[model samples]
Target chain A: MTAESNITWKANFPDSFLWAEWEDEEASVFFHRGSGETLLLNPLGAYLLKTICSEDISEEKLAQRTVRYFDLPVDEELLSAISVSLHTFEQKGLLLSSASQ
Target chain B: MKPLDLKPGEIARLLRSNGLRLQIGPFAVSLRSRLRRVAEQIAFFYGDYPRIEADAFVDFHIQINNPAGLRHWVRPQAIFSFDGFKPFKPLPEDQAFAMFEWGLNWCIATTSHQFLITHAAVVAKNGQAIIFPGEPGAGKSTLCAALVSRGWQLLSDEMALIDPGDLSITPVPRPIGLKNESIAIMKNYGDETLVGPPVTDTIKGTVAHMRPPADSIVHADRDTRPGYIIFPTYSAAADSQLDKVEKTRALVRIAEQSFNYHILGREGFRTVERLVSRCPAFDLRYSQLDSAIAEIDALL
Candidate 1:
């Protein structure tokens, strides 16, 4: 996965999330009462939540960075699989993609 | 530790499990964590035995039996213990460890104090505990998390330990758990120091625990007299207020809600009688945290 797509999904989460932590088998979740949304996440999704919590990044860069962190055998298929996870996060309202990306 | 032989004299015993050695004091307990985290909120809140002095001890002895059963014992000044036959199958993980903790608290609190433990959020100020008891989704925890942040000593977020002898509240201060929305909303109001990760999909939307302030934990051993009993109900976006409840009516309401009132029978009735006579009861419905805090603080 390219770094851009990886963390870019974090943009959807609001800054007011009170508690965001890995729930393990359930992955990580971010709770925001303002939005009244609690998003469940997977391992990569949780990583994305932490990355976004730390700072903002673009989609392509997020995808790339995520691939690097996993130490997977480098390839486009690996990148595409990771992007699918990002899409699931977006569907869950956990990530917001910038139109520019 | 030997598999706790649930015999008569074994109400309280110390042993080793999972590398942690726990000293089970009369009402309190002390444990050393075998894992990396200092002491999980559970240990600190429930293990308030006199051994809190911090002596080097073995890792927290852990026996999966009764999972959260360790929390049921009362603290140093009192002795209350029970041994339930382990269920052939562990309680399904869907129920929280907190529930078991509260259940165990119910058993011991009822046995020793002959008091009913209620599902509620309780707070104390000036030696009086104001109980906000209700069912889940009644906004008890949300209101409680807010009140403690505004200076109320958190007596408990889940268990209201009422003494049948005097109708007073025995403080069992512990971390408050907030499900999904409440977790975020509490932070929006400016409390950001919540501990523990959020658990998802078990029952509550998402859940997390906020540590009771240091002072609450330090004074976890102290008891607060019952002052006012308020049964709180929270709304999504509605006018908030507290109104006085009649004595006879409030008595019935409490008996219905108390965890141990039935355990002690007549004694429970008289104890609650003493409480209503000495304390005022109210029905509070609130949607705003600030207004709720202001209303309660002003009453204190």
Candidate 2:
């Protein structure tokens, strides 16, 4: 999946959803009640989603923060996974571009 | 006074005239019906519920009347009215008891938003309520009836009421609705006197309602903290097992089973989140009632 060009991804209308997050043995779990969707995310994805929800942040900045938050070496595979998950969230209507906000 | 306090003839007259006012947990209901059988069943089944005064406030005003037409003469039919509005088309007259039970469920599920309502059967033991959320034919009511027979207090047999403020479960104990094989199964296991005769060929395929225990109805104001959420699925081919459900999946499933989860929005989210965080959830499958009862009893 690919995010649209020329727009920054964020949870522009987070209040329209009812959400909760908690840690499980397997992974961090997030539930969006308005979409009836449950997403299992690794630490990196969880931080990205949580940041986007609470702050006005761009997807590029979110990617940079994930690496710093995890204290990991910058890797292409990690960035690619975050990009795909962000695109999925956009398709699910959980996130929208800043231009549409 | 209880409905059973009046004689059968007197109950019929009261229902026909001023209607029967009764306190059903958090709601006061006034039921009016001209049909004698409706009066008899209500007196027989709801005998333990406290009667309400004539001047008391009523949450729902419901009536079942024989429709005024030739169909009432030819085959006989009943129409269910709620607060002066008929929400359903007429049904077979003999299905009046089933109609009343389903109609009242609809009223509560539709109107009561202060509490999050789930389509689940709930019972409490040692002051901890366990919710069994299931679809039709999932044997939820059967499991609930078995638990209630084993001295567990029935909170509800169809809807689990969760207060949005504290995430506690309030008791709205009503009759346990059993269908098809469950009717005979409950009758064989518990007192036959507690189970009404099966109403044949309704939309749910031969439905019967078992009277809730007297204590459950008497102490209907009691609410319990939620302890567990179990999804019970009955299959003759599968062995009895209780598998732990991950908290995240459990949260989504409960919201899916709830009638007002989406309507309540943020409050609904926080309620389920708090509930799932505190309680352990499981996926329970059973072929026999005895094993199921034993396993569930061990959960407490």
Candidate 3:
């Protein structure tokens, strides 16, 4: 799948994820965990994770929200790029396609 | 010979056996009971008119006639139960040693502790402990006990001692409290180290505990940086796995787990805030001990 695909993901985060976090000290990874699939979330991925939980939407909408919150310059190129990233996430089963959800 | 009303000498003897040196209020105690562990250490006392005191650490204290009558006393200030296997068959032992440990925990917690007391099993490695603080049957203690065979050290079997001053978790690798099916469950996962005979009926079916591995008890007082605070639940239908969770949420969850959160009040909020800012938190839903160990080890 490419980034432009318009689908919403459908994976439920567990209760323990309430205070989940990730930080890099000395370039290493550290994050809280729950009793489900361990979803590796870096800064951008974590931001997206929070955004999706806050509000579910299509890839187009997701890109728009990212731009709105993070102040990324909105453009077709950026949207397409984000869509591609989201597609990879769907393939890995980290997030469900909005349509499927 | 009431459990809660301990003679000073009894308290000192326990600390001496465990090699723990402690001073409570004005009572000073030392013990060497660290080498052995039992199923349950309950200190029973009687009195609504006269109260008792001790400088010792214990497991559980029973105020037969609480001096603070009519009050639903929930939390304790100090405690120091061990991970020794003792059975509660036939009849029960004095367990005065266990009583002292629990009493001390109550005293300390009431005096300076202002957090909730959750029935969880916390473990640590490299001075970093994960606070698996949750309610009964949350599978916290069960999962925690299983990890011992996998090399994870036990930080506590019941409460997560959150230090308000530093916001770091104090090490409390007490006995791994097990109840009902858990007692048998531990036998299946690792070499059985039964504590006391099962205390039947009360609640959670037939209940018993397992002595934590030796290393865990020896380092019971050692402080650990709170690294991960997970709320785990055991589901038999599946293998174990770890899920990533967030901060403001962790704050709320910790608030839920506090035994005396309201008592701790503003200081509690500040302490929790510090924890949220520094420690990693998660929501775990797993059934496999091996899988849990591998995933948790990665976090470490």
DockQ of 3: 0.03
Q: What's the true lDDT of residue B186 in model 3? A: 84
Predicted complexes: DockQ each: 0.01, 0.32, 0.03
For residues B1-300, write the lDDT of model 2, one tens digit per residue.
Answer: 453477678778888998888888899999999987798789888878888889999999999989887987888999999999999998998899889999999999999999999999999988899999999899999999988988999999999999988888989999899999998899988888999878898989999999999999876888899999999999997677999987777777887899988788777777887888999999999988889988888898
Give stretches of model 1 more than 4 Å off: A1-101, B1-26, B30-62, B65-84, B87-113
Off by more than 4 A, model 3: A1-101, B1-119
Worst 10 residues of 2 chain B by lDDT: B1-10
Fnat, one value per model = 0.00, 0.24, 0.00
Per-residue lDDT tens digits for candidate 3, residues A16-83, read: 23323324321111122322223434455666666665656666566667788768777777677676
**lDDT, candidate 2, residue B236?**
93
For B1-300, candidate 3 gives per-residue lDDT tens digits of 122244445533443444333322122333334212221132111110112234445433222111232332442122233232221221122333334444445544554443434445678888788878787788888888888767788777777777687765655555566777878878888877445555564424666656656566455546677787788888887766666666656666676677666565555555765776787777778887778777788888
Give the TM-scores of the predictions, in the order they appear: 0.57, 0.88, 0.53
Worst 10 residues of 1 chain A by lDDT: A18-27
Ranking by DockQ: 2, 3, 1
Worst 10 residues of 1 chain B by lDDT: B72-81
RMSD after Cα superposition, model 3: 13.4
Model 1: how far is B111 from its true place, Å?
A: 4.4
